[model samples]
Target: MKMLINVPETVVSDALRGLAAAHPDLTVDVEHQVIVRRDAPVAGKVGLVSGGGSGHEPLHGGFVGPGMLDAACPGAVFTSPVPDQMARAAAAVDSGKGVLFIVKNYTGDVLNFNMAAEMAEDEGIQVASVLVNDDVAVTDSLYTAGRRGTGATLFVEKIAGAAADEGAPLERVEALARRVNESSRSFGVALSACTTPSKGSPTFDLPPGELELGIGIHGEPGRERRAMMTSREIADFAVNAVLEDLEPTGPVLVLVNGMGATPQLELYGFNAEVQRVLGERGVTAARTLVGNYVTSLDMAGCSVTLCQADDELMRLWDAPVQTPGLRWGR
Candidate 1:
């Protein structure tokens, strides 16, 4: 229960305030809990909006900027943002082209975003949605009907956002998003569980010297819990699962994402192993990102995401991006 905060209820709001202070380029709608780029509604470009719970930092919120999300609605810790929050973001960012919602495949996220999209449409805003379901962990989990969405969310947002930033039409951007999801797969392993600030305790319990395979970001039950193994072995397990699911046979985009507490040194070591495994399968990593992009609060572990990239996808991925969380080549 030991956490640095004034009160449990105010954790998300307080953090949003801090986020606004820390990054002036982002405008925080404190009342609505939506974060957007200061220069929103970019004239003719299709807007990109994505959101979810608040615990995972640098996700939807930190990703709001040029070449990424136009707006991001953050909810309470581990809770889906309300439809009003999303509708406000969509309205604020939508230009003449349209707005695309990047929704993860969780039940609450799907439902809330759907309601928001309908609301936006009622106001004469053209809207499209791309659902991310690249987690090969489970077909039906506690929070989703089909496979859960995880690391591939970053890939979808970045690649599709790049296309949108290039003035691509809403339909073309939506199609690119779907292509990213279709070509991507992910698998995660957890050494420890995360503690939501509101709960003030770990979401799940894992005994020392053990790990949970195929874990979800919300601390949901994974495929299995087993004794701890070496980093190479763990990488083998995760990368193999994604490879088997996708059967990718060409250049791929690789992301070795820390679940929060895992150090960068260890993540690089894990990334090496993942690349080694991919090399054995005759797949080359055209672009690789290692570090904490998507996280599960303070949980310790990592997930591997593999996206089979063609020339167009690779080009889009390498496009300049200027966001708080991910920025390069700008």
Candidate 2:
């Protein structure tokens, strides 16, 4: 349960400082808790903004760059950022073309971003919003009313960011973001609970030889916990859960995401089983991404997200992106 931070009180601030030092292309405002791409307010392009709790590294913050988020507001660990943070981010990134807020389905995130959108509009900066509720695991969770946002947050950000980078207007960018979210579904399985910096202990009770299926990113209680299963078994259950909900007829973009602490070796192996299951189900994978994208703090598990893709979505997914966490074709 030991954490590396000097103290729990400054965990978020300390991480921000380190992130600032590590990535010069991002304008990291440690005090205000806003991370923005250095080249923000790109002329004639719709701005993209997203954010959430601090536990998930390389998410909203790490994704600020070309073909992704223009600005991100990092909140306290497992907490939502204030409206001022999002409003400031919106103002900083909004060019004449307006901004789109990509919000996850957590109640706090939804409410705060909604308020921020109003605040931005009050300042004469047009703003649109897309809510992501792609988690097929649960209808309601500890932090959300509907399905909690998980892996597909990455999908929405990447595809919508590509569209925005291509000079799509606010309405189009917003529409594309919503479409990506609607087209994606996710299922997470946790082998172990994550320890928050403040708690210095596991967030939930997950005994040895047990695993939680459909776990939320914050270690929220999931569908069920049972004796630990093999990667192939877990993959079968996770992939089937998504397919049942997604019912995707066309090829899909697959994301085999680690829950922070799962090693790449295990994730890649899990991805193979996931691909096997999809193939058996007659589902084609247009593209497959492995490793951690959206994650819990240090949980030992993985999530599978499937985004039913059309030619346009696939093209956008293939677009060049230069972000700290996800980079390709740049």
CA deviation > 4 Å runs, candidate 2 = none
Model 1 lDDT-worst window of ten: 195-204
Encode model 2's per-residue lDDT on 262-322: one tens digit a residue. 9999999999999999999999999999998888999999999999999999999999999
For each candidate, the alpha-carbon lDDT, in order, equals 0.93, 0.93
Question: Lowest-scoring 10 consecutive residues by lDDT in candidate 2?
Answer: 1-10
Candidate 2 C-alpha error for residue 153, in Å:
0.5
Q: Which candidate is the best by lDDT?
A: 2
Q: Which pairs clash in model 2?
A: none
In Å, residue 185's CA in model 1 sits off its true spot by: 0.4
